[model samples]
Structures are given as C-alpha cells and as structure tokens.
Target: MDVLISGASVAGPVLAYWLRRRGFFPVVVERTPRPRLGLGGHAVDLFEPAMEVASRMGLVSALREARTESELLVLERPGRPAAELRLNAVVPAFDDDKHVEILRGELATILHGVTRDDVEYRFGDSIRTLAEDATGVDVTFESGETRRFDLVVGADGLHSRVRELVFGPESEFRHDLGGYFAVFSLPNYRRLVGKIVLHLGVNRMAAVYPVRQTKDARAVLMFRSDTTSQHDHRDVAAQRELVRKTYAGQEWELPRLLAAMDDADDFYLDTISQIRMPSWSRGRVVLVGDAGYSPGPAVGGGTTLAMVAAYVLAHALEEADGDHANAFAVYESRIRDYMRLCRDAAPRVLRNGVPRNRVHRAIAETSLRLLPRLPDRVRSRILAGGISGALSSFALPE
Candidate 1:
C-alpha cells in the first residue's frame, strides 16, 4: 500500500516508520522546507506508552541522552522568596519509570532519522486538495503536483489543512480553552544549567529553562484571555505584538524576555484549544494525532497521545490486513476513550497550572514548596489527582 501522511513533526514520521515496517510504502509531506531537528523547540514529555513505542523502535537511549535534563525547578514570585523543587519528584506524579522529556524538535529529528532512509519525505509542500474515491485518494499539492495514494493520513497538528479539507472548518470542531501559549528561543544569559526558572502570576505565567545540548534557553509565556478572537497562526509579527502587550510592565526578567522576543526568529504562538470530533476517518482519508484529536498543547499530554495514537493506528492497519475501513474503525475504537480523557482533563490542567487569581497563585506556590518535602507515595497520590491520572489512563494495544 502507498500511504501519504501529512505533517512530519512527530506523528507523521512515527506513523510512517511503523507503516513501512508493516510492508507499506509511506510518503510524508511537511510544510517546513527542511526537517525540524536538533535542539530547537520546546520541551515535551513522553509518558510510559509513548516511551514503549520509542523503545520498540530502538530510539529510547538516544531520546534519554537528548532529554531536557532540568534537574531543579525554581519558582520566582514578584515579592516572595523563590521556592525550589526537584524535577524528578514532580515528574512521577504524571508519568511512570518509562518517561523522558525531550525537546520537540529533537524528538522529531530522532523519529525522522529512523524513518528517512525508508520513507519518501517531501518537504516545503502540503496538500492543496484531497479527492478520495473508492480506489484511492487523489491529492494535489500546493506545489501544483498531483499524486494518488491508497490512503491519506493527516498526522498534522491542530489547524490541520487535511482536517479542513476533509472533515470541515477547524472552528466547527475546535473548542477554545480561553488561553494562549507562546514560546521562543533566546541566549542562555541566565546561565541556567540543569534548572528551570518560573514566574507564576495571576492570569499569566512565564517560564525559562536551558537546553542542555546547546547554550540557549527556551522562554515559554502563557496567558488567560476573555475573548476567543481568532489569531492568524502565520502572522508572526502580530503574535509577537500580542505577547508584548500581554506581558507589558511585567517584572522578574520579563522585560529581558520581551526584548529577546523581538530578535527571536523561531517565535510560535497559538490558541490553547482542543479538537473534538465524532469520528476521525472518512473513506480513504483518516486523521491521526493532533490533527484528529488534540486535547490541547502544553497543558494536555498531547505529545504522548500523538505518539501512542500513531503507533496504534499502524497496528490497526496491519491487523486488518490493509482493509482501511476496518483499520480506521479499530483505531478510533481503541483510542477514543483515551482521547476524550485527555480532552476532558485539559481545562483542569490549565486552571491548575496557570493561576487565575492571587489565591490560586498562592496555592500553586504552596504546593511547590510542600511537594518536595512530602513522602514519595503521598506526593504521587496528591499530584495524581489531576493531569497525571488522565495521562496514564490509556493502555496501548499489544
């Protein structure tokens, strides 16, 4: 079978890898001109299930070496003393022993590296239109080239062109969680090695952590918003402007961060939203990962979900013997509950992670101060009441 998978960041490459192993030819189309590899991009966590998928592919050791080894987390408040905690204690609340947090770009590069030699990767292009018939999907690319494939999988992220082309408009299925997330790279002026600096404010939060592999740091800024006004994902200038306006007059290294934002070329800003769909497949075309059912970015376990979903999808296809309809059905049935759990947990995760008022902020800080001192089992039990439970809710198929 000749399969065309859209979006090469994480899920596309993963799906391509598994499909190729199952004796299928997979072609990946990425909008970026080149593969996003190396140490760039934000830190993302892979839970036990996703880690199992990587281990099966023989990339866990490389992933472990490339982890964003931030051993300590320091919370900086405007007028209060900073509190410190170990990263390992906090991580177990959400993941098991099989967990690794790596940069999104590094993970993509590793996934691509495993599949590139066997898969056909077409960069700097995307699907312009997809016309599916009984036999195959006729795809026209933005580059004006046309091709036919036995199957088309939209492993694309939120705001997927594939979903828009086949399912409907994004707004029809998107649920805005009333927040925005922005991230960019800057020089490691703070010299923050093996540590993360965080500033939690009412209705807003800012964090910076060093990338161990490089002499650079990643600044993550998130804020709650009242309006659901649409922002163009491609408008970098406008996004930067929004961030500056939102963080104006903020203290504790924010001014420096904002100044760095002006010169940072890899700025990314997007609404923190979830995609809820009744179904993920239509005839020869199917959607996977964030393209089909993103819980939300950052707050939700999106990276873990994407990896596990892609792995399950390939297994489903293989089991069905290339009967796409049956495979899609099995894939959806297996992961639907898991997807919903993540989606439902996103709002609570966001609310707890990003303080909405002074009291919330105090509670968050107190938790940080108290978490490290508590016994391991007690701490895990307490923290597992939120996103942790939802993250480990899914069981991957054998």
Candidate 2:
C-alpha cells in the first residue's frame, strides 16, 4: 500500500520507518525548505523506553552522541540545598542513566536519516487539500501536484492543518490551559554551569539551563499569562521583546538571561495548551503527535506517545492485512488507555504551574517537599504500567 504522511518531524518519519518495515511504501511531505536549521526547538527529556525504541530503529547511538549537553538543578527554596530535588527526582519513573536530551531538530534529522533509504521524503511541500474515499485518499499539495494514497496521516503539529481539514477548527478541539510558554536560545551570558536552575514563584516561573555550551544555551520562561497576546507565531523579534517586558524586574538569573536573548537566531513563543481531540483518526486520514493529541507543551510523555503512535499504527496495518481503516482503529484501541494517562499527566501541571493564589505556591512547595520521600520502586511500577504496553511489540513484520 502507498501511504502519504504530512509533517516530517518525530512521528512522521518513525511512522514511515515502521510502515516501510511492514512492507508498505510511505511518502512524507514536510512543510519546510530543508532540515530546520535556525528553528529553536526545545529540549526534550527522552526516556529509557523511548531510548529502547530508538535502539530498535538503530538511531540510539547518534542520539546519545549528539545529545545536547545539559545540567539539571532543581530550585525549590532559594538558599536551601536540602529543599532542592533533581527534576528526575520529581518522578522516579524514568531511569536517567539512559535518558538523554537532544535538540528536537537533531532527533528529526536522525529519524529522517534512518528512514530515508526506505521512505520518500518531500520537503518544502505540504498537503493543501485532502479528499477521502472508500478505497484511499486523494491528496493535493501546494505545488499543484496531486497524488493518491491508501491512507493519509497528519503528524504535523499542535496547530495541525490536517486536523483542521479533517476534523474542524482549532477552537473546537484545543483547551487553553491558561499558561503561556516561550523557549529561545540565549547567548550563554550568565556563564551558567550546565545545570537546570528553576526560579519558582506562585503562578510565574523561569528556568535557565545549559543547552550546549557556555557560549550557546537555551532559556525558557513560563508564566500564567493566558491573556498575553502573541502577535505573530513566526515573529522572533517581538517574542524576544515579550520575554524582556514580562519579566522586566524579575530577580534571579532571568534578567541576565534575557539580556542575551536578543542575540538568538531563533526564539519560540506559544501558549501552554492541550489539543483534546475526540478522535485522532477520521476516515482515511489520522493525526499523530502534537497534531492529534498534544497533552500540553511538555507535560507527560508526549514524545513517547508520538513514537508509540507511529509504531502502533504501522503494526496495525501489518497485522490487519493492509486495511488502513482497521489499522488506524487497532492503533487507537491499543494505545487509548496510555493516551488517556498521558493526557492526564500533562494537565497535572495546573496544580504546579498555575496558581489560584499565593496558597497554590505553598502547594507547589509541598509537592516538591514530598517528592523525595515518594517511593521510587512504586513510581517505577507506575512508569512501567504507563509506557510498557504502548511499545510492547517492537518487532517488524516478517
């Protein structure tokens, strides 16, 4: 079967890899000129299970070798070392020894490289119109090129064009979680040690971590600015100014961090919201990753979810005898429970990131205080339950 996939990021290439392994041909159309170079993609905590999946795809070594060098430091109370717990300490679910973070573009590059031999990649192109019929789908690209496929999937992003075309408007699907976040690269002004330092408050907070070297690092600031309007999604200059204005008088290293912000080549700005889709698949086209079901920005295991989705969808097709519809259904059925949990875990940040008042700060502090005492063994069990079955069958079709 010939399948068409949009968005060549995490999910698209992984799906293409699995589908090609399953004896299907996939053509991926990405809406970018080339590998995104200057786009400042955020750092993601790639988990052990995810690493296991990457190993299966044969890209684990590259990911580890190219991982962004980082140091993670937790800041609970300002001067108290005892109050500080590592981010990994917050949830003992993952084994950090195997967990490493690479830039989003780096991972996409690796995934694309791994699958390029078997899958066709069409960059600087996107699906403009999609019409579905019983047998397959007729896809129209922006360049006036038309093609037909056995199935179509949208792994685009949070503002998935396929979801809009296949499902509906963005407002009908996304639920604004009253938090806004912007991630950007800052020239290593503070000469910050390679560590994640959290400056916490009630409803507002900022974090600065060493992304690469003291010369080049990434800074991300999140606050409860639900009403803060972002003028343009692609406007980097304005977004930098927004960061400067929002935390003007803010103490800690944020001021020094923002001072170096304007020099960044790429700065990203967006809201902390989740895409709550009733169904990820509709007719012959389905959505994956942030396109279909984004559990807010970086809450739960979203990257893990996308990887698992790709694997599941491909396996379902292999098992269902190339029946794309049944393949999608089986994929959804297999991962729904884990999907629910991922979605739930994402919004759990409301209690932490959002505050009803100053009292909520106390709650956040309390959660941090109780974090260390929580049993790791028990947490590991929960992690096992959450991530186990989703990627259980890593085997390809014989």
Candidate 3:
C-alpha cells in the first residue's frame, strides 16, 4: 500500500515508522522546509503507552538520554518565598521509569532520525487538494505535483490544513478551552539550570524552564480569556503583540522574559483548544493526533496520544487485511473512549497544573512543598489518587 501522511511533527513520523514496519510504502509531506530540530519547542511528556511504543521502536534508550531532567519545579509568587518540588517526587505511582519527558523538538528529531532512511519525506510542500474515489486518493500538492495514494492520513497538528480539506471548515471541529498559550526562547540570566520556574497572577501564568545542556531557556505564557482570540497562526508579530498586551506591566521576571522574546526567532503562540471530531476517517482519508482528536495542547498528554494513535492505526490496518473501512472502524472504536478521557482532563490539568486563584495556588504550593517529605508508600498512594490520568495505562494491539 502506498500511504501519504501529512505533517512531519511527532505523529506524522511515528505513523510513517509503523506503516513502514507493516510493509507499506509511506510518504510524509511536511510543510516546513526542513526538520525543526534546533527550533525553540516546549517540553512534552510521554506516558506509559508512548514509552512502550518507543521501546518497541528501539528508541527508548536514546530518548532516556535526551530526557529533560529538570531538578526542580519552582513556584514564584509576588512578595512571597518560592515554593519548590523535587522532580523525583513528582513521578507518579506507577513505574516511574515508564514516564519520560523531553523537549518537543528533541523527540521529533529522535522519531525522524529512525524513520528518515525508510520513508520518503517531501519537505517544503503540502497537499493542496485531496480527491478520493473508490480506488485511491488523488492528491495535488502546493508545489503543483500530483500523485495518487492508497490512503492519506492527516497527522497534522491543531489547525491542520489536511483536516480542513478533507473534513469541512475548522470551526466544525474546534472546541475552544477558554485560554491561550505562547512559547519562546530566552537567555538563562537567572542561571536556572535543570529547573522550571513558574509565576502565577490572577488570570495569567508564566513559566521558564532550562533546556538540557544549553544556556538558553524556554518561556511559556498562558492566560485565561473570555473568548478565543482569532489570529493567523503564521503571524508571529500579531501573536507576540497579543501576548505583550495581555501581560503588560507584569512583575516577577516577566519583563526579562518579554525582552528575551524579542530576540527569539522561533516564537510560537496558540489558543489552548481541543479538536473533537465525530469520525476520524472518511473514505480513503483519515486524521490522527491533534488533527483529529487533540484533547488539549501541552498539558493533555498529546504526545502519548499521538504515539498510541499511530501504533493502533498501523496495527489496525495490518489486522484488517487490506480492508480500510474495517481498519478505520476498529481504530476509531478502540481510541474513542480514551480520547474523550483525555479531552475531559484539560480543565482539571489547567487548574492544578496552573492554578487559577490565590487559594488554589496556595494549596498547590503546599502540596508540592509537602510531597518531598512524605514516605514512599504514602507518596505513591497520593500520586495514584491525585493524578490518575497521568498514570493511566493503555493496552495496544499485538
């Protein structure tokens, strides 16, 4: 089978790898001109299922070596002492070795590294239109190249052009989560090595974390908004302006971060939203990762979900024995409930991960301060009880 997968981020490469393993010729189309390995990207977590997928791919050791070992998570408050949590204590109850956190770009590099030699990667191009018949999908690229494929998978992230082409408009699937987030790179002037420092205000939050083995740091700015702000995703200046206006006159290390943002060439800003589609497949086209059913960005275990989706989809196709309809049905049935669970986890994560008000912030800080002092058994119980989603395990098809 000749399969064309769009978007070469985490999900696209992963799907390509698995499809190649299943003896299918997979071609990946990335809009970017080249691999975004050196770009400024936020840290992402890989849960148990994703780790299992990596282990199967024989990339876990390399991923472990590339893990972001932030020694501390510091909570900075105005006119208050910073509360700290040892990263070790933050490990969930289930096997701590199963969860791995790495920068998005680093993970993408690792995934792309293992698959580049095997898959056909077309950089600086994207599918302009997809026309499907009973036999295959006829794809026309923005470069004016046309090709036919047995199947087309939209592994693109949120705001996927593939989904917009195959499905209807984006408004039909987009479910705004009432917030916005921005990530940029900055110099580590505070000398915060192996640490993540977060500052919280009434309706806004800002965090800076050190990149492994680098003097540069990554900054994330998030805020609660009354309604979703509309802007072109490619418009960096407009997005930066929105962030600046939202966080004007903010104290507690924000001014320095803002100044650093001006120097960053890879500033990324987006709305914290979820994509929920009733069906992920239509005829010869299907969607995966954030393009189909993103729970939420950053905090929603999106990386893990994407890996799991890739694994399941590949196996489904193999098991269905060339029946695309059966494979798509099985794929959707197996992942739908889990996708909903991930989607519902967003608000809870935002609240606990980035506390809203002073009271919640105090409670969060107190928990972090007390976590390290607790006994191993007690800590395990607390983690299992408190963060069930983080520790949630998924069984994959053999």
* Candidate that would win on TM-score: 1
lDDT of 2 by residue, 1-398 (tens): 89898888898988999888878899999988885543247877666556766778787778777776554466644565635556555434333435767777677778877888778989898989998888988989998999999888899988888999989987788777777787777766556665666767666677776656226677777777656444455676776676677788866676676766666656677777788877889888888888988877755567777887777777788899967678788787877776777777666555565555778877766766666667877655544553332333233222
* Model 1, residue pairs in steric clash: none
Candidate with the larger TM-score of 1 and 2: 1
> Which segments of model 1 are wrong by more than 4 Å?
93-97
lDDT of 3: 0.84
Clashing pairs in 2: 71-194, 71-195, 71-196
Q: Cα deviation of 363 in candidate 2 (Å)?
A: 4.3
TM-score of decoy 3? 0.95
Candidate 3 collision pairs:
none
Off by over 4 Å in 3: 93-96, 374-382, 385-391
Kindly list the per-residue Cα lDDT of model 1 for residues 265-312, writing each as its tens digit. 888889898998999999999999999989988988899999999999
lDDT of candidate 3 over 205-258, digit per residue (tens): 899988865888889988877657477778888888888887889889888888
Give the TM-scores of the predictions, in the order they appear: 0.97, 0.86, 0.95
2 against 3, candidate with superior lDDT: 3
